[model samples]
Target: MKRSRAVSLGILGAAAFGLAACQTEEQTDAAAFSDEQSCVAAAAQSGWFTREDCAATFAEAKAVHEETAPRYESQALCEEEHGAGACGGDPAAASGGGGGSIFMPLLAGYLIGQALGGGRAMAQPVVPKAGGGFATPTGGTQLSRLNSTGKMGTTAFAKGPTTAGQPPMSRAAVASRGGFGGSAATRSVGS
Candidate 1:
C-alpha cells in the first residue's frame, strides 16, 4: 500500500539519519584525538618537559603538563615558537588561548548543527494545511528550512508552505487553525 511505502520511507529516513549522526560523532572524536596529539607534539618542542622528562619528574606526564602551563605571554610564545624549554621558562605557555588545536572546530560544527534544530523534533509546522488540519511527515524538513540561516543571508526560520493540490481557505480559518491572534505565542505544527 502507498501508506506502507510512506512508512518504509519514514523508517529508512530515520535509519539513515541515525547513521549520519554516528558518523558525525566519530568525526568529533577523531578531532579531539588529533588535538591531544598536536598538543603533545607542541609541548615536546617547547620543553618544560618531555615524555622522558616526565618519567624523571614522576612518570605521569599528563598531570605534570596540566600543572605546568605557563603564566606569561613571552614564555608561552618562546615555547610555542622555539620548542620545549626549561620548566622555569615562562608563565604564559599553558594559557595557549585555552588550548585549541583541532577539536574546537569539530565541536563548534556540532554545536551549530544542534542549535539550528535537533532540540525540537516531531513537532507541528507553521504553515497552513491543505487537508484543513495540521499534518506533516515526521522528520521531513528541507535543508534550507533547517540550515538556511546562520552567517548566510537567509532568515534563521521560515513558515513552510502547504503542498499543492488542496482546497481554498478563508482568512479567518487559516488564522484560527494556527492558534495565532491570541498573542500567547501558540506553537504551530510546522513551527
Candidate 2:
C-alpha cells in the first residue's frame, strides 16, 4: 500500500510538471499599423488605445527601430534579408563615427499591444521581410499585414539587443547571429 501511494504521488508530480510545460505564453490585445496616421485613425475604434497612445507608441517604436534594427555591411545584404527597396544606409553610421558601409532596413510599421495589467500600451517596431510581411527587430514576432488587430503574446513587445553603434555585420556574421533570420516561430494573429 505504501509503495502504491509513493508511485501515485510521483506520477501526479510528473503530470503537473507536464501540464506546466504545456502552458502557453500570456497574450494581449495587439494591433499593427503602417504609420502613425493609421494608428490614430484606428484608435477611435480600439477602446484599448487612444490618440495619445498612438502618438506615444509610434514614437517609441521608431526609436526602438533605430536602436535595434539589424545592421549589415552593404545595401545588397540588407536588401537580401529585408525586401529590395526596404534597405537604407544606417542613419547612425552616417551621422556618427561608424563606417558608411553599414545598412539597415527601413521601418515598415509598428505593433502596439495593450499592457496586460492595464498600464500604457507596449510598442514594437517592425521592418520588411525578404519576401513579404513585417517582423519585429528581433524577428520574434511576425505580421502578415498592417491595419490588423488580434491577440499577441506579451513577448512580442520585448526589446531586442541594440545594434546602433555596433560594427556592421558581414553576410556570414549576419547568418550566424540569427536574430534577423526569422528563426522564431511566426505568430500572426490576424490578416
Candidate 3:
C-alpha cells in the first residue's frame, strides 16, 4: 500500500510538469499570431482544436477587435496586426514614434564647417521683394563676399559648377562626390 501511494504521487508530479511545459509552448505559439485569420489558421493547423473551437476563437477575436485597443510591440507588429499602411495614422501602443532633435546637429555642423573653411558659401536663390529690389536676406551671407573680384570663400570652385547644363550641383552633391573620402579633387580625378 505504501509503495502504491508513492507511485501515484510520482505520476501526478510528472503529469503536472508535462502540462506546464506544454502550456509554455502554447504561449510562444500564441505570440506568433498578429491577427485573427493567421491566429485561427495556426490553431487549425496545430490539430489541437475542433472545427467548432476554431470558429468560436475567431469570433471572439473579431469581437475583441471591435472593442479594445491593439497593443503593438513595434510599428512592424502593428502593421502585421492590421496590414501594410494600416499603422500610418498612429496606432495605440506603438514604440519609437516621437520626433527627435533633427535641427540641432544640422545647425551645429553648418556653423562648425563654416568656421573650418571647408564649407562652400552658396548664393541664395534670388527672391524678389515686393517693390522689385532684392529681398533683405533673413540672415546675412556666411562671410562677406571674400573679395571684390567675386572671390567668395574657398580657393576651390568659387561658384558651384553645373552639370550637363543642369542647375549647379547642390551642396550635398559637392560634399558627397565620390565613394569614401570624396572631395572636389577626387571627383575631378575620376572624370
Candidate 4:
C-alpha cells in the first residue's frame, strides 16, 4: 500500500513535469516558425517569372561565357585565382549564418531516452500482477484515490458481496463521522 501511494505521488509529479515540458516545446516551436509562412507566401507572390525569358537568358549567358574562354583554361585560372568554390559555388563557409551552437548533448539525451523506452507503453496496471508480475504506474488515476470516506470505495472491484460496477465512492459521508476504512461511522437522519 505504501509503495502504491509513493508510485501515485511519483506519477503525479511526472505528469506535472510532462505538462510543463509540453508547454515549453509549443512555445519554442511557435517562436521559431513565426512569420515563416508569411515570408514564403510573399516570395511566391512575385509574378515576374517567364519561362521563355528564363530560357533565353540562360542560353545567351551560356553562349557568351563559353565562347569567351576555353573551359579547361578557365577552370585552371579559377582554381589558381580564387579556390574550389569556383567549381561548386556552394560550400559550408558560403552558407554560414547567425545560429547558436548545435546541441550535441541534447541529441545524445534524446537518443538515450529513446533507447530506454521513453515512448508510449503497452497496456499494464501499476500493481502486483494477478499472475505475479508488477504493475508499472503510468499516471495517477483519480478513481484510485478514495474520497474522504471509510467505505471500500464504489470504485473498488466486487469482493464477495460488493458489486463490481459501482460509482466513484459510497454516498454515505464518512469524514463527518470521523471514521474511515469500514469503521463504525453511522449517521442519523437529523444529524
All candidates: TM-score? 0.15, 0.82, 0.21, 0.18
Question: Which residue runs does candidate 2 get wrong by more than 4 Å?
Answer: 1-21, 177-179, 182-191
Q: Give one digit per residue, the lDDT tens place, for model 1 in 91-126.
A: 222244444221100010100111123232111121
lDDT of 2: 0.75
Query: How high a TM-score does candidate 2 get?
Result: 0.82
**Residue pairs whose backbone atoms clash in candidate 3:** none
The lDDT per prediction is: 0.21, 0.75, 0.22, 0.19
Please, what are the lDDT tens digits per residue for candidate 2 over residues 41-87? 99899889999999999999999999999888889989888888999
Sort all candidates by lDDT, best to worst. 2, 3, 1, 4
lDDT at 136, model 4: 18
Clashing pairs in 2: none
Question: Candidate 4, TM-score vs. the true structure?
Answer: 0.18
lDDT of 2 at 56: 98
lDDT measured at residue 180 in model 2 versus the true structure, 0 to 100: 67
* Candidate whose lDDT is highest: 2
Cα lDDT of model 3 by residue, 1-191, tens digit: 00000000121121111112112211111111223344345444553333444344445433332222222224443333233444332222123354321000001001000112332211211111121121101111122111111112121112222211122223344335431112321111111
Full ranking by TM-score:
2, 3, 4, 1
The candidate, 2 or 4, that scores higher on lDDT is: 2
Question: Candidate 4 lDDT, tens digit per residue, 35-140?
Answer: 2232233224323322332333334323322222111112333232223333221122224442321110000000000111232111111222122221111111
* lDDT pick, better of 2 and 3: 2
Q: After superposition on all CA atoms, what RMSD does each candidate show versus the true structure?
A: 24.7, 11.4, 33.0, 32.2
